[model samples]
Target: MLSKEELLQYSRHIILPEIDIEGQEAIKDSHVLIIGLGGLGSPAALYLVAAGVGELTVVDDDLVESSNLQRQIIHRIETIGSPKTESAKASLESLSPTIKVNLLTQKASPEVLNKLDSERFTLVLDCTDNFTSRFLINEWSVSNQIPLVSATAVAFSAQLAVFNQKLQHACYQCLYSNMNLPEGNCADQGILSPVVGTMGTLQATEALKIILGLNKADTSFLLTYDSLDTAFQRFNIMKDPSCSVCS
Candidate 1:
């Protein structure tokens, strides 16, 4: 049950017919894990916390740098040189004191990821940039039967996808069976600031929908955005018959 303060705090959300009191309550009962505190993870973390997710675990071993302020909105000029996880925890908790923000100030190593499996997280956001991190996170999500919201941004383009093993959808690997595409490293390839933000906010939107048991896709679908045209495209992702992760 929500306290009077909470009910008042989330009055805006409760007013939405799609997300009424029960949906707000479900949001309070859902726990989410977000990997990376970069451009994509920043907005996702901020919104999820502000929306009152039951618990949020953030993983990032990087430190806040001046370069990050261009896109990673969760960190501040004062937080420069501090661990990203610490910076994120401080910012998120300040947004919603009732929500617990767990910090993993270490790398997203297999051991660390495995320990999280016991938590039975309701969903995961893969905001990491590289295919290696995405592949690893996808494998973990598939094995744990947890849905994953993955996003990537390079230059002015971004892609968003959700993979839910419980729904038997195609895993992330099915989208990119090879690492031949342009990598998502913003340092290597320049990016427009809002490009990543658009996808990150979408990731948070899809996650909340899943938590509220609304419009959860039964099959995998990928959403792509082009800032130049201000266009959004959706494509189906079929599960590869030989997919090693979610075959």
Candidate 2:
């Protein structure tokens, strides 16, 4: 049950027919895990908290740096040198005191992933900047039957996809089987601030939709966005028969 304050706090969400009181309640009861506190995780965490996800666990081994503030909106000048997970925790708690934000100020090592599997999370958001982390997350999500929302951004382009093992949707490896693909490293190349923010927000939207069981009718697709052109494109994502992760 939501408190009177919470009802008023989420008035806009409750007013929506697609996300009425029941949906709002479901959101409030959901637990989410967010990996990486960089550009993508920043907006993803903020929106999920604002949407009333009851518990959120954020994992990031990096620290706040001057370079990151350009896209990582969840941190501030005052938080420089502080662990990203701690900084994100402070920002999220300030947004919704009722929401629980857990911080793991360590790397997403295999051991860490194993520990996370012991708990039940409604879904996971993979906002890491590397393909290795993305691959590891995909493997774990597939093995544990958890839904995963993954996003990547570089320069002016961004891509978003969701992999739900429970639904038998295409896994990450199934979509991008080649590990030799170019890394869209913001540090190496460059990234438009809004490009990552836009993708991360959509990641949060997809997560909520999945939790509300509102994604059953939507066909599997990968969404690509170009900030320069302000264009969005969708490509069908099908599971690979020989996919090592989900096959």
Candidate 3:
């Protein structure tokens, strides 16, 4: 049952045939854990909060720097020196006071992953730009049987994927069997502002679809986008029987 305020707040969603009041309620009861507060995480967090996700946990240890202001729109110029987790929480809370926000102002470690109450969260979003954190989140989510939405963007390209243990879906390791690719981040390689925003928005949309039970097919695939050519490509992925993390 939606309160008067909730009903009004999610009126747009309530009217959608796919996401009626029941779907809106599911979103309001769901929890998402975001592993980074950078470009991809920024828009994903903002949209999730706006869509009425009940609880959000942001994990990041970095501080807002001048260079991050272009795409990390969640943090403002005034928050340049503040911790990323704190800045993201403050901005999200201001956007939707009804949503509960949690801040983990520390780097995510195996210890932190082991301590998390996976049952309390419906999904995990891997917005981390590094391969190490990406693999860590994938391993933990696979072991805990939690669905994960992963996105990464650099320069003009981005990738999005959804991994779920319940469906025997492919994990990150399944796609990138080895992490031998050259390491490059936004700090080293400049990124177009809208590139990250587009990827993050898609990540949020996928998360919402999973939460609302609006998606009936397995979304266990990879979506690639190139802003320069405005081309979107999707590659089908399957769980690798020899996957080191999920197998």
Candidate 4:
């Protein structure tokens, strides 16, 4: 049952026909795991907390840096040199004190991933900046029959997708089988801050929709955003028969 304060806090969500009290309650019961606290993970974590996710487990090993302030909106300038998960916890707790936040100041090692699977997290948000982490998360999601919201942004472009083995959808490996793609990042190739912000925000929106069962079938499609052209492209993604994870 939603308390009076919770009802007021999520009143807007409760009013929606698709996400009335039932969906809002579902959001409160869902447990989401977010791996990464950098550019893409920052806003994703913030919105997920504000939207009333019941329990959130955030994992990141990096420390806050001055350069990250440009796009990592969850950390403060005064938090520089602190662990990102701790900084993010402060930001998220301040936004919604009722939600439970578990912080892990370590890499997404296999042991950690296995533990998360055992705990039966409702879903995973893959906000890491590297291909290795993305592939590993996708493989785990597929193996565990869990849903994964994955996104990537570079320069002025970003792409997002939801993968679920249960849905028979395309996994991240289907999109990028070769993890050896030329290495590039915001530090070296340069990224428009809002580019990652756009993808991160989309990741949060998709997570909420997944939890609420809103437009759930659209998980088969990939949404691409081109800030340079101010356009969004949507296309259906078929599960690759050769996909090592999904197939």
lDDT per residue for candidate 4 within 1-247, as digits (tens), equals 7899999999999999999999999999999999999999999999998999999999999999999999999999989999999999999989998879999899997788887644558889999988888888888888887788989888888889887666767888887785457578788888999999989999999899888887557447789999988999988777778887788
Off by over 4 Å in 3: none
* Model 2: CA > 4 A from native: 178-180, 217-219
Candidate 3 C-alpha lDDT tens digits along 12-100: 99999999999999999999999999999999999999999999989999999999999998999999999999899889989988789
- lDDT of the candidates, in the order given: 0.89, 0.89, 0.90, 0.88
lDDT of 2 by residue, 1-247 (tens): 8889889999999999999889999999999999999999999999999999999988999989999999999999999999999899889999998888888988887889998754579999999999899999989888898888999999989899877777788889988895468755898889989899999999999999988988773445789898888899988788888988788
Better of 2 and 4 by lDDT: 2
Lowest-lDDT window of 10 residues in candidate 1? 176-185
TM-score of each: 0.96, 0.96, 0.97, 0.95
Tell me how far candidate 1 lies from the true structure as C-alpha RMSD in angstroms: 1.2
Q: Write the per-residue lDDT of candidate 1 for residues 1-247, one digit (tens) a residue.
A: 7889989999999999999898899999999999999999999999998897989889999999999999999999999999999998889888988788888998887898988754559999999988878889999999888988999999989999988777888999888885476644799888999999899999999999889878557788999999999999999898899888888
User: In candidate 2, residue 198 scores what lDDT?
Assistant: 95
Q: Show the colliding residue pairs in model 2.
A: none
- Summing lDDT over every window of 10 consecutive residues in candidate 2, give the lowest-scoring window: 213-222
Clashes of each: 0, 0, 0, 0
